[model samples]
Target: MKHLTGPAYVDIRERALRFVRDELIPLEREARLGPEDPWPRDLLRRIWKRSNELGLLKAALPVELGGPGLSTVELCLLKAEIAETGALFALHVLGELSGPPRVGSLMNFASAYQIERFFKPVMEGDKGICFAMTEPHSGSDAASIKTSAVRDGDDLVINGRKHFISGSPFADIAIVICVTDPEAGPKGMTAVLVELDAPGVRMDETYVPMSGQHIDADIVFENVRVPAANVIGGFGNGLRLGMARVNLNRLLHTSWMIGAARKVYRMSLDYARTRMQSGGPIARFQAIQHMLADMATTLFACESMMLHAAMKADQGEDLRMEASACKVFISERCFEIADKAVQIHGNVGVTKNHPVELTFRQLRLARILTGTSEIQRNAVAREILQA
Candidate 1:
């Protein structure tokens, strides 16, 4: 029943799907069947606890770190398979990255102690994380961040604002990026893990990023002091750490987009086969058949690229060029495939009852987040030129 299953990963896919159908799908259906029935916070907590107990929390993480230590390819396969579940459930499947100005930077460069204190807890599935990097002015140019973290004795005092960070509403902690020496530019940057319960941390009430998904608000740090031990990675390593996270996250994202595309493709195919157009099913029509074939072809190519990139990453191969290549291919192809899926659905595709609409909306985020298609192209171009 499982198609395109790979070595070591196929078993994980089967297990994840069983969880998907039995636990995730049922909960999703229950949530949808009711009028305004969001899963209660407690229920979500319980689901996460059960998932963690089931070893789904870190299926790809090393067993010592409380994960399965799956190869990078295995993680990619699992990521794609789990995303097929749904948005609320996917968070439990793929570990969270508290974004820029957050603990992710520390994960790369923190001292062993700093990592144990901040990064390990989340990777171990004990805590949820969010990133505070994007401010009103400092959109994607991470090097130009304005948040200041002034050193004071054993503490670093932070001051600035960040917006559009997801999962902050329920996160136990966050990664905050701040400029330690404004004069030194990006080289003076540092990332600190600021506990949400810490002093001088405030969430602005009105800064809503997205509805339904794990969207949160503006974070204001007014002289919030973090101990020197909390400094993530090396001095000025925030930029590189941020870059690595962005590059690696694309692989995870590749899995999710592929999952969404699969859903869209299935819906499109079903409609094509059953929905009558002229004298027979629309699937018989050349127009619809062409769309279906194109969709399938794109999926194959994109998934192949993703798996190749993942395997390379697992082998400690240089993945920058590959990540950029995969992200560009997956993101652009996803839009084309999703658009075709919607077209096949005709009028009803716009409605909420159809999954394509939601997939369409969510897939759009792929183009912007991590790196834009334009940005990916630029990276690819540079790599090609250097080669």
Candidate 2:
């Protein structure tokens, strides 16, 4: 399923590219960061439905689950392009990180009941889902997670706090990790599919994004009652599930960053070549030329790294370290490209009038969220020593 190839896949990629440029980007521009205007939920539904019509929303799932059910390569292609439009919009449309667990990795480990109860709603686009692993105390160290879920009869009683739970505030279901048997240490942690409406589940607050209105939630579970069937997998398997899901997201993050870098690089390249400065076009200046070169070089590198990880994922190999490396590398370099492009544009780039500034803010968030670069570096270093 991962070894996706053939001409039809390339055609789908092109169609995605066109849809992004022609439909997605234009619609999103109208909803750029604002103070009072919450993104209209109805409008988003319509847009998502349109994406469904285009067979985009299903790019990562199997055909039976109502997705494009594409090969890994096809998933990569759609992800890179859809992500280029803006992640906030992607969240609203793609069902909020629906690619990784909601597709299969999580599903494979989830009990049949968990799959039908949690994953189905997300795939059908009737609900949103988030992976709740990183906590204020744990972050990258999954072993240090403090959340606890105790089994009581047929229910798992959960209690803990999680921070930076991406899209959790708006999500309908939360796939959480909690220590089911703390005596076993990290192995004690378990995955549970707790509905947001569950008795003890509460979204504490939202993490306001840099350039968009997407809500990253801080979730609190106080004796949250999860049914036995809600368990994603067996006890201790939580860490394994968390790691694989993180790698999947890391790979997806790189692809999104590639799209982000490409958008601004191309914009700046065009700006550099045509915009006149001090009697002649600024692009003709040696300094501007260097900036252009830097942006292009970094962009190429980010894209290559993204493709490398995507290829590894297709091979059905462990990409934990590689995905971490890509996340750290692409996250940093992609932001740098956006920053330099903005510098090249001077005053024009700083204004909301230009997309470069918008992209600059967007790329900045990418670095800190989705497993920070610092966390990625720590993971990669550990992998090197083990090897």
Q: How many pairs collide in each candidate, listed in order?
A: 11, 2
Global lDDT of each model?
0.72, 0.73
Question: Cα RMSDs of all predictions?
Answer: 3.4, 3.3
Give the residue spans of candidate 2 off by over 4 A: 1-5, 18-37, 62-74, 86-88, 91-93, 96-103
Question: Candidate 1 regions off by >4 Å?
Answer: 1-11, 31-40, 97-124, 205-212
Model 2 lDDT per residue over 252-273, tens place: 7677777777878888888887
Using Cα atoms with residue i matched to residue i, what is each candidate's TM-score against the true structure?
0.87, 0.87
How would you encode candidate 1's per-residue C-alpha lDDT over 1-387 as one tens digit per residue? 134345446666676678777887687677763311333545555555666666565565555555556776777777776776554566565444332123433444567886677666665556667877777786767887888888899998888888777666666677777787777777777767788878998877464322235456688889888887776776676665656567777777788889889888988988888998667898988888899999999999998899889878877887778998998889889978988988999887877636787777778777877778888899899998998
Deviation in angstroms for 162 in model 1? 1.5
Error of 1 at 229 (Å): 2.7
